[model samples]
Every structure is written in C-alpha cells, then in structure tokens.
Target: MLPKGFFHRRVVLTAGLVLGLTGSAFGAAAGNTATNKAPSSTSPVGSTNVTVADPTVPRPPGTPCTVQLFSGVAFNDFNPRPYAYAPPAGCGTRWSKVVLEADFSVTAGRQFDRTATLWLGGVNLYFGTTEEPSSTVAPSWHVERDLTDYSALLRQAGNGQALIGNVVNSTYTGVIYGSARLLFYPASILAPAAHAPDAVVPLGSDPVGNTVSLATPSSQLSKSLSLPTNVERAYLDVFVQSQNADEFWYTCVPDQYAAEVQECGGGNFREAEISIDGQPAGVAPVYPWIYSGGIDPYLWRPTTGVQTLNFMPYRVDLTPFAGVLSNGAAHQVAVNVAGANNYFSATASLLLYLDPHAKTVTGQIERNTLVGQPPTPTIGDTLTTDSSGNITGAITTQLSRHFIIAGYANTSHGRVDSTVDQTVGFGDIQTFTINATTYRQVTDQQTSSDGVSQSTVGGFVTGKYSEHMRYPLHLDVNQVTAADGSFTLATVAHQGDEKNLAHQLFGITLYSAKLSNTVDSDDTLAFDASGNLTSHSNQQSTQTFAFNDSLGGCYRTDVGSFSGAVSSYATGTGCPGQQNRLFWFTHPDGSPENGNAVLGW
Candidate 1:
C-alpha cells in the first residue's frame, strides 16, 4: 500500500511541472574566504523576513477508515528536489530583464523545507539561497559589475558555467520565462563538510547527488590544479574536508562567497584540472537548485557509493503508472515490492476508510499487540511484542459520521506466538452536536499483560456544559475511575452552585453527584492569535490535528507533552490499505493524499 502522505505530494509536484521548470536560474561568480560575503546588493531581493503561506495548493486528507500502520520512511530536514524549466521562447524576449519571487513552506515535521531566489539576464545570473535559519551562510548575488553586453557563448557557458549579460531592472515580478539551466552543484559543493567549520569533522557523505574527487591526492599548499579523471560535471566544485590539519585551502574558481573556504593570503588557491576521466554519470541539462537567504543546514545531495558526477537530466521521468487508483475519499494503500536484492517489481493496493466522529478507546489489550511500536515499559527492562493473531476495533462519534478512530490488536496466541503487547490506556475527545449544544465527551481505557495472557477494560464520562462551543475550547472535566471497575466522568456543573468558574451565582448543596463536587483535574488549553488551538493544559496529553495537503487528506499530531517538542510523520501517498508500500512512480502527482493512504488488517 502506498504510505500515508504520497497523494498530496503528487498534486503539489504536478502543479510544479508547468513548462518543465520553476523560477529562475542563479550562479556564484566568485567568492572570497578571507572576508566571506555575498555580492553586495541594495535592497533585499525580496523580504527574507516575510511570512507568507505557500501559493501551492494543500494536499488531500487520508481516509480515516483505511488501516494505517507505521512505514519505515523517516521525515527529517526538508530540501527542494531538482526541477527544470523551459519557458515559452517569447517570454524572456518580451521583457529585457526579469525578477522571481517565490515562497515555500512545509510543516515542522516534514522531510524537507527549502526555497531559493535567482536573477537572470541572457544567461543565469547570480542570486542567493533563501528560506532557511539565519545562522548559516552561503553564496548570494550582488551588483559587483553592471550588465554590460549580451552574447551567445557567455549566455550558454557550454559546460554548465554560463555567464549572464548584465543587470537590468534589479527587480521585477510575475513569472519570467527563458531557457534556464538549473545546475546541480557537485556533491562536494552541496556536501555537509563544505559547510562545516575548521575545527569540526564531517560525519557523513554529501546530501546532494554529485561528487568531485582529486585524480591524484594533493596538498593544501598546492595551488596547481591536480586533475581528477573522476570529475562528473563541467563544474565539479570541491571543499576542504579539514582545516585543523592544515592552515587553509582553495579551489580553481574564486572563493569570495564560499564562506567555508579558508584564505591563505588575500586570495584563495584553486587546484588546477587536467584531463577529466569519468563521463557525466547523470547530469540534468536544466535542473533547479533552490536556495533560501541562509544556507540550508540540512540541504545536500543523496549520497552514492562512487565518487562520480550525477548531473540533472534534460527531461526527468514524470510519467505515472497505470496501477495507481484514485477515489474521491481517503484510501489506505500498500505497495508490495517483489524482487531480489538488486531488482524488484512492485504493485500497490488501496484501502479507504472515514474518520470517526466520536468515541474513546479504553481497554488493556492483554496477550495482544497494538499496531506499531510496542509501548515502553517504565519499570521493566524488557517489553516483548506479539506479531500474530490480529485484533481490530473502531471509535465513532455518536453524532457526526465524518470522523472515526481505529486500532489494531495482536494476540499472544497466534500461529507463531512471540511476545504480547498490551495497550496500557487511551482516551479521546468526542466532538458532536447534541440538540443545540456542542459537547466534548471524554473516555479512557487501560490494560496489562504478561506475554502469555492479558485482559483489561476501562471507560469514562463527563457532564454536559455549554450549548455553543468556541473554536479553541478549554479542557473540560474527564477521568477514569478504576477501583473495582473503570468509568470516565466530566464536570457537568459545580456541586450545588450554578455559578462556579464562570460566575453565574446560584448555589446548591455540594451533594449533587452529576455536577463534579470533587475537582479531579485542573487543566486548560492555549490558543494562537488566530484562535487556532496551540497547546493543552493537562499535565499528560496526546492531541491530533488533521489537515489537507496537495496529496489529499493529511494529518499531524503531538503524541505527548507541552514542553517536549512535537514530532510528526506522514504515511500513505499511494496504495492504501496494504501493510507494505513501494513507490509506484518516482514522481507521482494529481492523486489525493487519501488515494495513496494504506490500511492493513
């Protein structure tokens, strides 16, 4: 089954496919390490300080009924993938000069968040990296020399390093079209070490795709270029791996803007090149490399085993597979990959389900396994998990049919019994329209297990308070009593007083059983300036927020805590309902996020 966040991505990418390109192309003329700085400019290209929602549409939501399980893909720092553009022939000729203003944003828990701005004339002019944390630095564009003359050779710098004519309007807006060459910097240029400081050592390989290695190992003192037959792109940029061992280092091109490069004297040295060895492995003719104001700390090429050039392609594979299915609602998808270690065949399946309107799940799943990772054992050294004998349950709101809650239970007595994983306890905030009042019902459950056998049952209830519900409501009363059995309760009213917290003075006795006479919990909620719910008051909490994305139905949540940082991951972009998922299309677009969601029994 396709994991949960795929469909929405397809939509966003599909939109990005316009004219086979994104914004404009940029270049780094030369940078100095002694006084590392971007080309001096007048006003900011576009305000790096502005906070605007992305213009791209949101993805689709995941189907609530689909069986959702954890997939192995991890979400870390976000970066823009390579893209190219071939603007209409007349678009560039229509305007003497052009400026590009683009905005990009992703949720905190997404895989990558990257954006770049570039200026171009006859050729790709230089700009800078944008949309990143401020501490990091990278190459940027400035008005060192005015736009003098436009020529063909300079515009088509032949081997990837093209020189634009001259600056015209310094600034312009609305889509500018041209034949842009989105160059993919050598893996070395996009390497993590290139951005590392003198004292530090790089931990791993480059995040970006290309690589540049010296044909023959040379010394930092050698200004003469030591040709590496392995240079992949015409411009295979490199950086000093370590400064702690030596004084300083340099490259063939100027390093005025490569802040990571160290200066020996007033100038940085470059190792000259002779004859190249390896052919361009995979270089895209016109690929897009995004840049935000500050350097993207996490942005880098995908590491490969060989130190070879892998440039962007003139035309990437953007076709979709025939096996992919799309429905209007959320669907859980699973992609089954069948192949040996090296090659594989894949097929995807879709499972659709709706979110429950309301209901709390409370029960100790004894001798069973809860869908994903087993719960941590607080006092014990080992917590075993059972992977066989499936158990599933659902939670639905009494009023609305739009939402639902589902759970997978694994029993200890399976065909191949391993260990038992039992649900300790769980609760839910049930939202439904009762009569005219909007009420939130609280329910909870708990369970214990000993690998071989286990059992548990828990429930809770709360009092009905107000008729009209605000956008961000405060924490209402909710608890589970388990002396002999378990049941939940919430504050319907104050013991005998009609006026308690809100000040409607009508005092009754403290004997009303339905009205919370004893305060079991004192929790609350916090909202943002936009009335959007931000945090909760409860000491222990697990809240989920659902939203839409380009892929279709998508969601994010804070599993626990107020002070602890919230982490979110997504699943289901293709085949829904299946346990395993594979990429049906390296580039999938248009399908709703729900269509790619997956559900497993």
Candidate 2:
C-alpha cells in the first residue's frame, strides 16, 4: 500500500560482486573453468552441515524477480484474519520455490538435464573444461563439495542472461545471484521431511472423472538461488493442498535479514450480540470467542503486559511478556482466563525467532479451570516464517478495521448479498502504516429453492487518497430490503501554506450514492469528549465509528454521522408497536447493535 512514489527500483548492489567481476581480464579468458568438482565417496556431498555446489557447476539463483509481500486480513475477518503475501500488481500472484536434493533417482525422469547449473539474472550457467578465450567466463567461486571441505571452480560461458538488478534502470543489478545463495546459512532447525495425504487426481473429462494422488516430500535441494535480499525479508511460495487450507499451517523459513522481531503490546475486550428488543436477534464475531479443546485459533501472546483479545465465540484476555530466550529467537508467555466450567486460565509461551538457521517458532500453551489448579499445557505448533522487512511484506498481526452490524432472523442466512459481516481490524500502530492498504472485494452469493444468485463489487475508490485515509463500505440484505450498498471514504488534510492548500483544495465530497439521483449532501460529525474524529460524513448514510479506547476495547461514541434507510418490512403486520424497523451497528471485533430508539415519521 505504499505510495506509488515510494516504490522505485535502483541498482541495489554496485560495489560487491559487480566490481569483483569487472576488476580483471582474467575472468574474460576463464570461460572454460569447471563449475564445481565432484566429491569422493569418503566425502559425500549430502553428508555435510555445509552444503556447496561442485566447482564445475555454480549455484543458480532459481528465480530472478522482485515480489512485494503483504499479509494479515484481506477480507475474511476470522479472528487474527488470514495472512497473505501478494506480489505486486499484474504479476502472477502464485509464485513457487522448491529446493530438493538432486539425486539421480529423482531427476531421471525430469525434463531438465544437468547435474550442476548456475542461474543468475534469469540466465543458466553451463560449465565445461574447454580452453577457449570467450567473454562468457565463470567466476572462481568455491562451493562445498561435501560440506566439510570447499571445492574450487572457475568462470563459465553463457550468453542468454536475464536482467535482474534494478527494474527502473533496465540494468540488471543487486548482489550477484551466485554470491547470495552461497552465503545463505543452512535451513533453520532441520525439520523432518513432511508428507501430504493421498488424494485422487481430479478430472474434468466430459463423461467421468478420476482421482490421482500426488506426492511431494519436504526436501531442500543443495543449491542456493537469490531473489532480492537487501530488505529484511523472507517469503515462501507455498503450494497449499486443497484439504490443508481448512486451517492455518505454515511452510516457510524465518528471515535472518530482519533487523529485529519484538513483541508489541495488546488490549482489553467487550462483546455483545444485537437485540432488537431484548431477544437474541443476531450475532457476529464481535467479542466472539471459541472454546474448542485447544482447537480454537485464539489471539496469540508472546510478550508480557502486551495484550491481545480473543473475539470469535469465546472471549479471553491475552498478556504478552518477553522470555529469557531473547536471542534472534524471542519468546512470549501468556495467560488465558475466564473463571468455572466456563472460567479457565493458563500460561503459554511462543518463540519469535528470525535467524535463517533458526527458522521455526516453537512454544507451548496451557490452561486450567482454577486459580491454584495445575496448568494443562499443549505444544503450540511451530511456524517457519520471515520477519517483516522495512517496506514490510505484510502485517503478520491483525490489521483490518471493521465493525459488526448484525441481527437474528427466522432463518440463518449464509454470507450472501449486502449481508452485514462482523469485521475486525487494527489501527495505526507502527503495524498499520501506508504499507497497509485495505482492499474490500465483497462477493454476495446464495443458492436456495427460489434459485441461485450472486453479486460482486469492489471498493477501489478507497485506494485513491493519502496514507492516513480511512474508508468504510457496507452491504446489507434482509426481509425488508431487496439489497443495499454504501461507501464511505475519509482523509485528513493538514493546514499548510495557503497557496498549496488552495491549489490542492480541501474537504471535497467526491462521490455518494443511494437508491436514486438524490444528492444526500447533509454533513455530520461524531466525536468523543475530546472531539477526536470518531466518524464524520457528508451524508449518503455514510459513517465512521471510533471506540472510546482504541483497539476496539471501548465503544463510547458514534464518531461519524450516518443517514440511511432500511426497507425491510416486519414478518407480520400484527406488531403492537411502531413499524418494525431494524437498525444494526457492528464493531471491529464483530459485536452487533442491540439498542433501539424509535424515530418518529
């Protein structure tokens, strides 16, 4: 979400490897040097802690391209939201990286043929001993023959090179692909090879389909490939199996390049379900909690005094504190509480390590029903992850800002139409910077006896302003209203020089729409006692809400004015009171509106 100007590609590396190559004419005639040397049986290549390529075939920087990563909640606000690492626009979002040992057994049937090939700037390296004075000369780099000892290699010849350096200059730049890979430390803790479950391959043949099982073992090939590494970042192109997507699982490494990995603080929680008239009308994830026997994905804690909340179907206070193991790996200990059959508490610990050689995060979680009760603890699963970089690939923590507007119905509606979804998000902690852009692409879909229907829309209008801008969009459908949609975008313009302010223009209501052409131009401002911008609007039923306390811990005021009409009619005309108009307000934590004040016509 960085401003377009913030994103520029310059020559990342000019002195290191580039100068090493241009220094002498020796590389010019070294075109026929070996890429790597073969290892002896006593020194097996796969047997050493230090892995290196044979001198004849240098290492290949597998993929030569730059990717902008982002994580945290994109749309679905299921607690910590889902984490995603998207590449820049237009580029294919699905990127893949595979590291497998190149034993003859696995590569026998593979299409590519070569024991050792160096990939640099999108080009492959083919090395052979031939005394020819050619410009395609390989560098004399040493690679591990078997981990214990290093083997020497010479330059090689290659003409088809892909530009990998700086995209802006049209000049391939950055650290040499071979050097980066050769320097990367070993994989964090050596994890056992993982396996996927068997499944029948699916077929779309007109008549019938068959299932086939695919096998992929967790293996790292003894080769190094570099992409962009100057930024403190680590990312993995994970291929999630269909079945595995049911929950959050990790398959990547930690970033040795990260500057630091620390535990930020947390907060309190408040939950409520909307009640039109004291009856359970509807519910969302607002202050929601889940009490599955250690199966629920609650907010995680890895630091002390640092707080987080559990808002799903169960509510729990989270405290975070740093542990003694604060090396590249940091740990957080937490306690979960409630008070009897429903009351439970426990202390849990989690690791936040970033060293490439120490990749996975391992910790434990424990809980009990009593104050003095011994804790029943379970091991928190390990995650191989990368610390966020300067530009920050994505906010690994909660970063979406949302509210809950919900109501109970005679029949539960699946998430389809302008239906109110309980949304949860974070505000401006160093976590929610310009790098955090909220893209709301909503798809309301349904299938029933009447028929099947689907409608889709996106709030691209939200991305058209400054970094501090906040936009809110809503969609709702029930018995009274056929469907409805609204968009609210807001940004602050600081007082500046008159000339710039005049030229720039201030307080402009770009667009607003309702049922027809009526211009709902009435403006409204909502504020807490301090008059902070809780919510404001030039009415199209637009609104912005602020919790008295941030992190949605306290909802004390309506920060913005809202003006909208609800068309839903009561299920029956037998109501004793005024026309049954249902109004719902949602919180970022998924709580819905319960109070109702009649508005006279």
Candidate 3:
C-alpha cells in the first residue's frame, strides 16, 4: 500500500518500467600511488552485478582486532534484526582508532530501493539506501565509517539492530542480506589514541527503531538528559533524510502551483534546526541526496549520486551551550526539519568532553541571536497559462539566514568563552513548459552553510574552527508524444557535494582539508503507442572524487561509463603534482597531518 503523499510516476502503456573518512596516518603523503580502478560492469540477464566505488577511508599502520557485529543477516520483512556487540578484548579499550565496515547484497529480481540503518546503544552508526535490483542485475556493495569519535559508546557491551525494511512476496521478490564488523586498532608507543569524547548521548526514538519521523516543522525528535556538571565542550551529529513525498523536495513547487506543475508542495527549501531547552542552538543545511531509483534510473548505472550509498552526518557544534547543559538539571536536545512535508526521518547523537581536573563547573549563556525559525523565503511565480490550457513560466524561491551564538564556562583552568557565527543560504529555480504534445521541466538548486567557531580565555583566542559546505543540483526532464502516440523521455542531471574544513590553535593552523564529489548523467527512453518500452539509449554517466588535506594526504579518482559498461578511469589528476598518495602523522597535540605540511587545502 502506498502511503499518503507518496509520488511514484507510472505510465500505463506500461511496459515495465524502470527503475532505477578517515583515519590514519600512520605516513600520509600526497601523491597517487597507482592507477584508478575501473567500476563494475553490468552483469548478463541472469547473473549478479558488482557495484564498485573508490576507497575513501584512510587506514592506520597498526593491525586491527576485528569484532563481528552481525553475520549474513537476511532482511525480508519490516522487523529489524537484533544483534549483540562487545568491544574487541584483545585490542584493549583505549585504542588508537575504531572503524565500522559492512557488506550488503540483494538477489537478482525486482525490488524498490530501501533505507538502511544500523544502531548501537541507540546511536546511529550508519545510514544509507540500497540499490534497486533487476532480473539481470543482483547488486552487492561495501561501506565503511570511522567511529573513533564515538569510542565512549563502543567501550561498553551493548545490543543493537540493523534495519533494512523490505517486503518479499510473489512480486517484489528481491531479498537483501548483510554482514558487519568493527575493527579496533590498539594504541602503541608511536601511534597513541587521540582524544575522544568523554560522554555520548543519543537523541532518538525508542531503541531498535532509532529514528523519529517529523511530518512538519513542529514535529521534533527530542531527548532529555542529565549531563555531567563539568562539561567543557559539546557537539551534535545529525542526519535528516527525506522520505515519501519529500524525496524530491528540490523539484517541488509552492503549494498553490502543485496541481499546475504536477509536483509536490511546501516550496523547495528544507533545513535541519537544532535547539537546546526550547532555545535555538544551531542549523544544519540539508543536502539534496538522490536515491538509486530516483528520477531516471538509467542515468545512475555505473556510478551513483554522491554519498548515495553512505551518508556523512553533518556536525553542529553546541559547545557554547555547555554551561547551560551542565547546570545539574535535565536538559532537552531537539531536532526538526524546517520545511518537512509528508515527512523526514531524523536522528542525532551528542558528544561531550569534560574538564578532567574539575569535578564541577558553572557558566551561562552570554548572548544568543539565532532565531528559532528561518526567515520567510522570497517566492516568485511568473507562470502563465494560455487559452488552450498550456502552461509556461518559471517559479523561484530563495532564502538566507545569518546568526551568532555565544556562551562561557568556568573550568579548573580558567573561564573560557566560546562563540559561533554561521550563515545559511538556499535557492531553487524551476521552469516548466507543458502542452498536449510536450511536457518539460527544468530545475536548478543550491544550498550552502558556512560557519566559524572560536574559543577564548582571558580575552585571548585559544582555538578556532571553520567549515564551509555547498550542495548544487541541476536536472532537466523532457517528454514528447508524437502524432502517432509514441513518446520519448529524455533526462539530464548533475549533482555535487563539496566541503572545506579547518582547525586552528593559538593562532596556528593545526589541520585543514577539502573534498569534492560530483556525478553527471543523461539518458533517453522510447515507448511505442501501446505503452510498451521499445528501447533505451544514449545512456552515459560519470563520477569524480577529489580530496586533499594540509597534512599532505591526497586522493582523486574519475570513473566514466557508457551503455552500462565502465569505459574510462583515472586517478590523481586533481592532486598536488597530479599524483595520488596518502600518508599521515599525528602531532603531539592530537592534530593530524598528511606530511610535514602547511595549513591549506
């Protein structure tokens, strides 16, 4: 049964359809060591296909003790699979690093893309979506994440669940199976464990079903906790995923024009807002994530959208509120999607660091200028209709916000002041041309968040951190019905995720990095008058990823495919000296470097 507001495009003459970090440095250098690997090729009609991606996580030099969280667990129903988790004993608790790895596969058959999530101790370890399977292409893939920051939670034994909601019946026959494990790297004389969060707090629903559904701006996923009194720093890692009608939020129009353009409403703007005890704390810009079965599936054959298989959570610094949260009373932390329609799935975790020397501390919020809600967007609609009922015009929506949050905490060392200044901006423009013979829609959208945080003691700056991120998307869909009733559907899409981050201490830059990933694709589908698909052609896609850090670590890869087969591959083209290489070393102060490096991307 389709849920309310669910939008799935189906054409009857229907022939069948369609469908669609980090670690370690042990010697991080910045050059390409080898050629880029080719992407997996599409399998024949009754076989399995291997979907591939370039490796993004850097590994430390030490050997790791592995702990199996779950093995060959099948997900053929809505019930989440439960599992037991215990830290690896041999590796010791104070390890240099921790990593999570998982593998998933689906039987070759028919199935829609499903959401996948893993939770341990009520905290989200992974969140992503599966690939759609076809009669000829059963797909398999692997994903990994660095969990060093959540080491506090991993140190204790716990129970968790893996959720990959699916249905298996005579129809929708695909079955998904998965396995996951954690790798613990023990600290050594040369490579010691980095400073990790002292406490971890989860802001989610009940256990197992660890995510909350927010149907509107007023809906929130909140948790009340009695935190430690000496809290010195705090951060929240948040994830907001669009579901049901909100999946294609960037393509939606204002409510009044929904029926006119055959699109969803609520405008094309969504942002994740965070609050502390009813007061605004911070904002996280939403990324326009496209799933495997979104739009024209053919466009994502050999390469998928950026972060489609593995999502990177956005981190919101809540350090300024540390004093208020440590006042000995239970405080509430909440999250919501500002423009959620139908709904959005949300989850978050709070990380806190306490002053080791002080058993108790005090502080207060000095100033808070962040509003609870974003300003109303400027909506411009120039759509026009002729006497024949044909529609032609453009609709544009844009919004921008800027604010500052400040607070101070008294610790054993001294009184420290923390302030955060941020700016968020969003813009979406869509143009439509509709008539009896043609249906065309084009959309261009961009979202960005830029912020900086600084810590000072006695009026002297002690630390500084800055981050900048941007998401850009462009899509064009055109369909034309010929006089004989036959029709052609063509689509062109370009999507990107880009980010830059840096940290400084005592006026010296300690760490800095830059990352960019993009995908571009186009395809055409033809159907006969009987509504039967005749052919699909002009299928092409490409993905490029580039990353560099001040420590001298560098990685870059480009993969291209045509007609469902990988055709070209390259590496290190965008790195320093056009070479791909990675080597990292941590400084005594816990700052990381790829090599003896300067502070720049």
Q: What is the lDDT of residue 104 in candidate 2?
A: 11
Provide the overall lDDT of each model, using Cα atoms, as 2-decimal numbers: 0.18, 0.16, 0.75
**Order of the predicted models by TM-score, top scorer first:** 3, 1, 2
Worst 10 residues of 2 by lDDT: 298-307
Residue 504: error of model 2 in Å?
A: 66
Candidate 2 at 492: error in angstroms?
A: 17
The RMSD of every model to the true structure, in order and in angstroms, is: 31.4, 31.9, 7.1
* Residue-level lDDT tens digits of model 2 in 116-155: 2222222111211111111222112222211001100101
Which of the two candidates, 2 or 3, achieves a greater TM-score against the reference?
3
Best model per TM-score: 3
Give the C-alpha lDDT of model 1.
0.18
Please, what is the TM-score per model? 0.17, 0.14, 0.90
Model 2, TM vs. native: 0.14
lDDT of candidate 3 over 39-153, digit per residue (tens): 3343222212333334545556789899998999999998989998888877788877777888888898777677888999899998887766667777777777778778899
Q: Stretches of candidate 3 above 4 Å error?
A: 1-54, 372-375, 574-579, 584-601
Task: Put down candidate 1 lDDT per residue, 81-121, tens digits, no spaces.
Answer: 22323332322221121222122221221111121222222
